[model samples]
Target chain A: MLTAIREKVLAGKRISDEDAMYLFASDDIFTLGALASHVAYRKNGRKAFFIRNRHVNPTNICVNRCKFCAFSRSQGQEGAFELTIDDIIGKLGKGQATKAKGMGKSRSPRSVHVSPHGFSEVHIVGGLHPDWPFEHYRNMLSAIRKRFPKLHIKAFTAVEIDYFSRISGRSLEDVLRALKQSGLGSMPGGGAEIFREEIRNRLCPEKIPGERWLEVMETAHRVGIRTNATMLYGHVEDLADRVDHLSRLRRLQDRTKGFQAFIPLAYHPKNTEIEGSYTSGIDDLKTMAVSRIFLDNFDHVKAYWIMLGEKISQLALLFGADDIDGTIIEEKITHSAGGLSGEKLTAGQLVNLIQKAGKVAVERDSFYKTVRVYP
Target chain B: MITQEDNSRISRKEALSLFKNADLLGLGMWADMARKGLHPEEICTFVVDRNINYTNVCINKCTFCAFWRDADDADAYLLDRETIFGKIEEAIAMGGTQILLQGGLHPNLDISFYVDLLRSVKERFDINVHGFSPPEICYIADASDLTIRETLSILKSAGLDSIPGGGAEILSDRVREVLSPKKIKSSRWLEVMEAAHRLGMRTTATMMFGSIETPEDIITHLDAIRQLQDRTGGFTAFIPWTFQPGNTELEETGRVERTKGRTARTSKLRVQSPATAVEYLRVLAISRIYLDNVDNIQASWVTQGLKTAQVALRFGANDFGSTMIEENVVAAAGVSYAVSTNDIIGAIRTAGFVPAQRDTHYNLLRFF
Candidate 1:
């Protein structure tokens, strides 16, 4: 079964759903990784990417209160707080000033394409605040764009966009377009937890349904807003559930060709209602390799270092991951769920990790444009 | 004249070269081929056993070991006969067929203490007592003024079944001199295994890499094991596990050096980074390819976790090693991956192999 899949992959043909399932269940991880690496090399030759970005989670007060989310808090709950637009900009401004000084000394002058704020992207995703108006999110994006004109502001998930549409009584396209006009460059892949309706419901009952999330993404794609796709695995999901999720994403990508990358989020079991352990390195690498091999239309697969820790993310490069996400100034969602990786990584450190893995470290913007390549 | 057998085997130079330059997945393919040649069936094996640490008090305080304690340490303990019996009884009730009976090398305990410990367990329950690693045996023999052969004869009569491959971190004396100066040298450890093999006792071989040793040291360890296995075909398996640097003195020294803003090279004790999964799989596959004389290669889920262990099945490991009803050594290092017997079986089946229950000698007892 695996050999046939390998042949298809080698012959530049797309593998079927059954083939992806077999690769997931197969113990031949080395071969799977090798095949995935072959495909990844064809797409990206010896180049791995990392972005100099900051993750600005504006609020944790969410109305959905999904069972698997340890990062969300109810309104007025203890530890529940919302960051105003000023607060978000203040954080990003301070972080950028400090990082710019560090980058000036370490980064090569030729390779360091320092933005006015030192970082090329600012990743913004937060809970759906119960009280905040949809205009508040739009204003937040516009404010960040005003402060740092050069920064690529990649904000909001499909679920958040869906919430925005509901709260504003607007259609999905209207909300996405409004945000885009307010400086939303792209969307981060989240809230697409599992496309299998049964598992998705059990994992996050109050969250938007799988179909709604897909609809929201499809709407965003049609509006010319490119986004990444994600599947949360290792929590109340099986191989078939994962295969179903990937098949749905692949189908959507075939139609829209809007997914810039596929990021497989490893479910962290800390502080969450989900009762399970962390995903093993074997499973993490296998997921990366499988996503890269299966998502033929997607140009990149990101090993989100915030979830995979430093070492496994480096190994994921060989397992078909060509992007390590970025130097996330601070990450909250995974940490709230007992994420063991450091909250932030320096740009120099990110380059070192990719280089040590025997790859050409390419600094990328939010849309994965090569800003600078560190050979 | 070169024979087909010699051509089939890789030399120390070739092994070292592979360690230095071989592509990880390429090495894995070679290893998977090697594994298929040995284990043609779609079967992987494991043992349902408990690691009964009779004592934690030791004199040889190796830096890499977090399980040892001083004789007077507040937490140090020596299990009594009844306590040992109770644990073995619990193990048997849980369908455990063997007990990995090992402990620290106490300076006070003589050969009689070990003999009685084995005899008492064998008298009450019919179980395989895979007891006494080479370090413990060497310590016991030296303390009792007996030869390694004499010590083996005494323990065999009392019910010692076989030896485990603990305390063989790396066979290079240069590594041993730095990692554990007080423990026996590489030759003495091999001598104990040789004596046990001569007595018709099958043992296992292990290598704990990812410490300060270079690629040369790893090949040296593999070569030593291969040479010994050639003389005595008593090794049932070769298990290569990464050194877990959690709560151990080694990690502490590294931390202290980093805090002082000094590079690792400036200090006499170079702090070792924990081995990544890539290095673990590379060494594991190479072990399978290099030790062609050895029949089985066991994966260390106890350190690498179950997922990597599942991957190890195709990387030349034919066994899941053990269910480990109880394990303390690696736990002391702050890395304890607890999985039940059913979990091992499930993982094997999920990895697309038949999970079979095996005894100490690799003889199949049952299949799931």
Candidate 2:
């Protein structure tokens, strides 16, 4: 069963949904990893991507309290708070200074800083505050843009975009264009937790449906704003649901070609209403490998270190993941839900992780453009 | 012309170089080839056993061990004969065929204590007693003023079936001096294994890497196992696991001090971060490729978890190790992954191998 799929992948042919399910079910994990590695190599060629990025959550006071989300809190909740534009900018500035100092001390003489701030990306995502206006999000982007013009602002999920459109009484296209004009370079993949409606309804009842999330992404891509896609696995969804989600994303990418990467977010089962344990290492690697093999149109598959932890994320590089996401200075979502990995990884540590896995570490920008390739 | 068999037996220098410079997936493929050459059938084996720690009180306060306790520590315990027998009885109820009886080196418990424990367990349970690692045996011998052979022979007569590969953490004296100053030295570990083999008792060997050991130290550990296995041909398996430094003293201090220039006390070897899954796979593959004489390479799901253990199938591990009805050593270090017999079977079957239940000696008893 795997041999036929292997032949198709090696020959640069697309695999069927059934073939992907077979790969997922089959016990040949090593071959699945090799196949994924082959496909990854064909696209990226031994170059593993990481970005010096900072994740800033503007608020935790979310209107939609998703079952699986330990990050979101109701308005006026004790732990719920929002970040002002100046507060976000101040955080980024302070983070940059601390990172620059650390990098200056530990970075080898051969590896030079690609960005002066020690990072090229600021990843912003947060809850759908009930009172915050669309102008608030637009102002936040423009303020960060005005402060650091060189820093690429890859912000917001499609769910947030959908919320902005509804809250402002505008269309999806108008909302996306407004954010882009406010200096949003790209979108981080979130909110597309799962495409199957049955699981989606149970997981995040008030959040936008998977179709709406895709619509927002397609709208963003059509407006010339490239974004990444994500699927939250190891929860209630089964193999078919996962494959269906990938198929939908691949179909949309075929039309828009907008998803720069596909990230399989491992469901961390802590402080959440969902009753589950952490996804086993096999499930994590198999998801990465299958995503690489099935989502052939997507240029990259990221092993998000925050959810997968450092060790499994490193192993995911060999299991068909070409990107380990980024040096997320402060990741609030996963951490709020009991993330096991450290909040931030130094650029040196990131390089060491990739290089020790026997691959070249390529520092990338928000769009995965090469910033620096460490030898 | 070099034959394929000769090529399979990698030299120590070659093994070290490969460990230093091999690509992760490439090394895995090579190890998979070696695994296929040994176990051509699509079958992976696991033993259903319970690790009954007779006592946690130990005089050898090894720095890396979280399972050891001082004689007066609040949680220190010595299991009674009834408890041990009852545990074995429960294990036999679950179709468990072996009892992994191992514990710390207690100063109070002499040879008579061990002999009686073995005899009592044997008298009750009709099961294989895979008891006593090299360190425990050496301790018993030293406490009883007996030789290693004599100690092992006495234990065997009391129905001790085999020796598990524990306490052989990085078979390098430099590492032992820093990580476990009070534990037996590397030579003594090997000597005990050799003595047990000479007495016609088959045993398993292990190496706990990913601590303070260097690449050279890892290769040295593997080579030592390979050399000993060649001589004795009694090592049924070689299990390599990462050192989980969670609750141990090693994690608290976060540095291994290595004395330099005889009198200099300032120099320190910075402790490395825990081994990543990639490093674990790399070393596992290397162990399988280098240790050609050893038949089984056990994947450590207890440390790496089930998924990585599944991936280990292609990394040259033909054995999924024991069901581990109860494991406290790694758990003491704050990392515990529990798996049932069905879970192991399901994992192996999904990983594309026929899962078989085996005895302590790696003999297949039943196929799932």
Candidate 3:
């Protein structure tokens, strides 16, 4: 039965929902991987993609607490923290130093793999501060841009964008346009817990609705800001829900062609309202592979190494993942949720991992530009 | 707590359990971790060897074979010493470090013929002579009216440096009976290999999968090799290649030629399609994780082509099998992927690895 579906996929026909369901339920992982890898090889050939960027989560304060979030907190909670503009610039400067140290660590004297202009992008996404006005968000981007104009600013998830629209009394388009004008280069894929309304209502009812999040992303794309998409899986969702979530992203990609990558974020149930163990490596690989198979129009599929540790991320290359987010200097969102994988990987480590996976390690900038190809 | 540390020990049960239940990606993770632990540096190894099949005449007409010819067939001509010596000379000039000499189990060939051939090759060229799989060794023993140990002793004294692990289609006798009943039984193949190992001769092990075998049968095969390696530690590497039923009797039948189901309990082995690249990598990765005592796992590029073989290096294979200047067995089986030395190095470099040349004993000879 899987052979039949695999033949269809080889023929370039889209697999049906039933085929996906069967694949999810079947124990024949290699067959599904074969199909997914077939699609991936056709799409990208042997090149595996990654980005060289830094992650800056500005604040942890939020108005609404999503059940699966381990990073959010009330304004005065015990562990809540926020950064001022100067503090962020300081960290970005420090991050530059750290990345420099990464490239200069006791290592092979091969050509340096970092971009000529170091730190290609600054990835900024964080909670919605109840008291912070719209200008705080706009000023944050302006300050970062003012300090480092060359760094592409990928900030503000759709949830944050929707929240900004609500608090600032602006249309979604107006909010996106304002941020873009303030040096918001693109959007990050987060806060998209699950697309199904049932799951959304139970877990993150106070957050933007699924339709609203999609609307915000579509508005951002309309304003000429490309973005990435993500799905938080391995929680209260079925196989049909996963397929449905991906299908929604696929439909949007077909319309706007704005999504540069699809990242399947594995749900880490540490210190969250929804209590559970971490998803197994098998589940993580399957989710990544299935997303790659479903989102044919999306150009890249990323295995965010922050959540799925280093080894599994390396293995993910053969299982339909073409991107391992980046050499994230520091990560707090997943860390707060009991994520134990280190906060950062050195530039040399990233190149060695990709190369050892028998893939050409291509260092990419924010818009998926080839920064360096570590062949 | 299997951290990415070197020499982290895992029990056979744990390894087999992973092979049975772990997802393909999970298995790859374990294998890659192991690979990293074993080879912390950025080196992948290959050898430059010419596969010199001395003759094509055979008595064991295995069902999956496409290379054997009848004794009276017009093409069934054995190479004399001069032709063989000229081939070796050409190989030496082309930078070949060894020669992989294998052939069908010819019925009329006596033990003296093999001894003379080995002596002639050694007398001519200063190259490693890795020849004679276990089945071929067993055939020579029976024809010479000697024990397997005696046969290996004679061949070793006559300049056979090591043995290549061929003719190990599937170690499970149940599957072996249906695939190649005329070949040496599973135990005899192992016994020949073990005798060679006891003689302090290193030999590689191989598994020809994707035929009439279940996952359990694969485990069985791996378990056999693992146990033997544990005892002697003489096995240098393990190579797993998919059964290419292209021009063979298996392809002609369109089904397994014997029983539909080998056992009443087991489901019929499907000959509908060959194992895909995914299956090949799965087996390769699992073998690396399982056979901890074995140091190297080679990629069978002749059957899988360059792309999959390149990918296999990441999965588990630390060594590329050979640069077959002339290979007839798999080529006759109709799935040949010819690659030159430059092509191999380019593929390895493009795949982000440094390609080094190794000899039969896996000693690094040069790095390109």
Per-residue lDDT of model 1, residues B57-96, tens digit only: 9888777777887777789899998898888889889888
Which pairs of residues have clashing backbones in candidate 2?
A: A27-B350, A27-B351, A27-B352, A282-B307
Worst 10 residues of 2 chain B by lDDT: B258-267
Error of 3 at A84 (Å): 0.2
Q: Which has the better TM-score: candidate 2, or candidate 3?
A: 2
Q: What is the lDDT of residue B280 in candidate 3?
A: 77
> What stretches of model 1 exceed 4 Å from their correct place?
A1-31, A51-97, A100-102, A106-123, A139-153, A181-183, A194-215, A218-224, A233-257, A266-287, A305-315, A326-365, A369-375, B1-7, B252-266
Which tens-of-lDDT digit does each residue in A91-158 have in candidate 1?
88865544364445645445443443367788889998888999998899888889888888888999
- Each candidate: fraction of true contacts kept? 0.36, 0.48, 0.00
**Candidate 3: residue A140 lDDT (0-100):** 92
lDDT of 3 by residue, B1-368 (tens): 23434565555566667766665656766687678778877688989888889889887777667777778877886878888888888888989999999887888899999998998888878999999998899989999899999999999999999999888888989988888877998899899889899999999999999877888888889989999898999899999999987756666343343322234322333354566555777899999988888999998878776646766776788887788999988888766655688878766764567899998898999998
Superposed Cα deviation of residue A252, candidate 2 (Å): 4.0
Lowest-sum lDDT 10-residue window in model 2 chain A: A108-117
Q: What is the DockQ of candidate 1?
A: 0.26
